[model samples]
Target: MSKILLVEARLHLRDGASLLFTIALPLMLLVFLGRAAGPAFPALMVMLSVLTLSFTVLPTVLATYRHQGVLRRMSTTPVSPLRVLAVQLLINLVVAVVSTGLLMAFGPGLPRNLPGFLLVFVLGTAALMAMGLVIAALAPNGKAAPTIGSAVMFPLMFVSGMWVPREYLPEVVRVIGDYSVAGPFARALGDTWVGQAPHLPHLLVLAVGLVVSGALAVRVFRWE
Candidate 1:
């Protein structure tokens, strides 16, 4: 398992295109929008990092392995397919962390409420990544995984205030966005960044989503 994790991490690093794009896109956005975009952009970009790994990179990698019979062949060996999946997830987590770190380095100051921010970040990452796992498990093939992930990603982005800030949206749309996973995610993180305690309702939503989605993903995951 350790070896697999190391190899996957190295492979992710070696993939220059992926590494550059994931790291670069957020950094560029920060440099350009950091001043004008206000406090929420940093958290949004962090969420974007998580989203990229979850909805884009993760599903493609897992589904491709299944499509190419890698997972199937691994079944003949002592290693469990779950181990490979875990390693893939661990690698992506590193990617997300690095991406977020870069944004923090160049973009904005640290979150005012350090502990609160950390809690929101951890829960948000888990909830979003678990959603990605479900997409990976259900996708029929490598090509389809990205498509499905993207389909899911755009709406979440919209509701999460990627396109329009939640504050600017009308009451109806704001209400919908509030209920969406991305909505509470951004809210909790934003609140913590500004030194305010995250709202209980937002934390509760994330906790429930994390538990329910993770359980479903594990239950439905396929080795091949």
Candidate 2:
């Protein structure tokens, strides 16, 4: 597994688009938004980092391997295809964590409730990764994964106040954002960053997403 992880890490670095989305874009957003909106911006950028890995990077890699018969070949070997997927998820999780660290180091304020923030961050990252796995499981090929992921990603971003602030959104939109995974995840993170206990409802929503999506992904996953 460690060897597989190292190989995946090399492949990830070789893929310029993957590097850009997973690392460069999030850091850029942190600098730009952190300057404009203060600590809230870094919190949101953290969410964006998770989304980039979950929606774009994870799905693409898994689908591509499946499309190329990589997963099928692995099934006949000592290396399990499931291990490959696990390694990919682990790599992306590292990227998200490192991105968050960069924000904390350079951004103005630190998360006041460190334990609470970590709780939200871990759960939120798992939920999003589960969602990404579902996409990887369902997409017929590499080309289709991005399309499906984008369809899901845009609505999530919009409802999460990526486009418009939740406070300024219409009542209906705000209500949707309240329930959407991204919205609650971002809110919980921001609240904890300011030393507040995260709202229970938000935590529950993310937990549910993690379980449901993970189950579906496992149930429907294919090697090729």
Candidate 3:
């Protein structure tokens, strides 16, 4: 696992887009939003941004690997599909944690509760990764993954009050946002970063999402 992750990380850092999205874009978001939304909200945005990073980027990268026949090629060896997926996921999770820490150290932030924060972080990352893999499974080519990823990510980011606060969006969009990935995840981040209680319902929604998405992702994912 460690070896796989190290190799994947090296490959990831070499890709300009992936590296920027993984490291720069989120930090930029944290800086801009943190300034605009005030400390409390910007702090939360860090986690929110990290969640988006995990779901959107990891799948795209994996899809690229699939397109290049890396995944298909892997099947001829002893490595399990599960292990490959696990390594990529662990790498993404590490990126998320590191990004969150950077925000705490440098970016503006609200309060934080470590225990609840970690619970939300762990579950939220898993749910998003499941969804990401499902996207990767559904999209055949690496080139297509971004389209799929954006389709999944933008709405969640938009509606989740990342761009416009839920209070600002039209009621219809607001309602939709509530159910969107960003919506629930943002709410969960609020609880985590601010030392508030987890919204059990929102967290459950995340769990259900991971289950459904993970199950489907497994069914559809192909080595080739």
Highest TM-score, which number?
A: 2
Q: Which pairs clash in the backbone of model 1?
A: none
Cα displacement (Å) at residue 193, model 3: 1.9
Residue by residue across 1-224, what tens digits does model 3's lDDT show? 66777788898677777657666777777767666665457545555556556556777778888889887788787876667888888877777778777777667443467788778777777888888888888887878887888887777788778777678889999888766665777787776676787888888888887788889988998878
TM-score winner between 2 and 3, please give it: 2
The CA lDDT of each predicted structure is: 0.85, 0.88, 0.74
Lowest lDDT block of 10, candidate 2: 31-40
The pairs that clash in candidate 3 are: none
The residue-level lDDT of candidate 2 at 87 comes to 95
Q: By the lDDT metric, which is better: model 1 or model 2?
A: 2
Off by over 4 Å in 1: none
Ranking by TM-score: 2, 1, 3
Residue 181 CA displacement from its true place in model 3, Å? 3.0
Q: In model 1, what is the error at residue 224, expressed in angstroms?
A: 1.3
TM, every model: 0.95, 0.96, 0.90
The residue-by-residue lDDT of candidate 2 on 49-139, one tens digit each, is 8998899889988999999999999999999998998899899999899888987887776899989999999999999999999999888
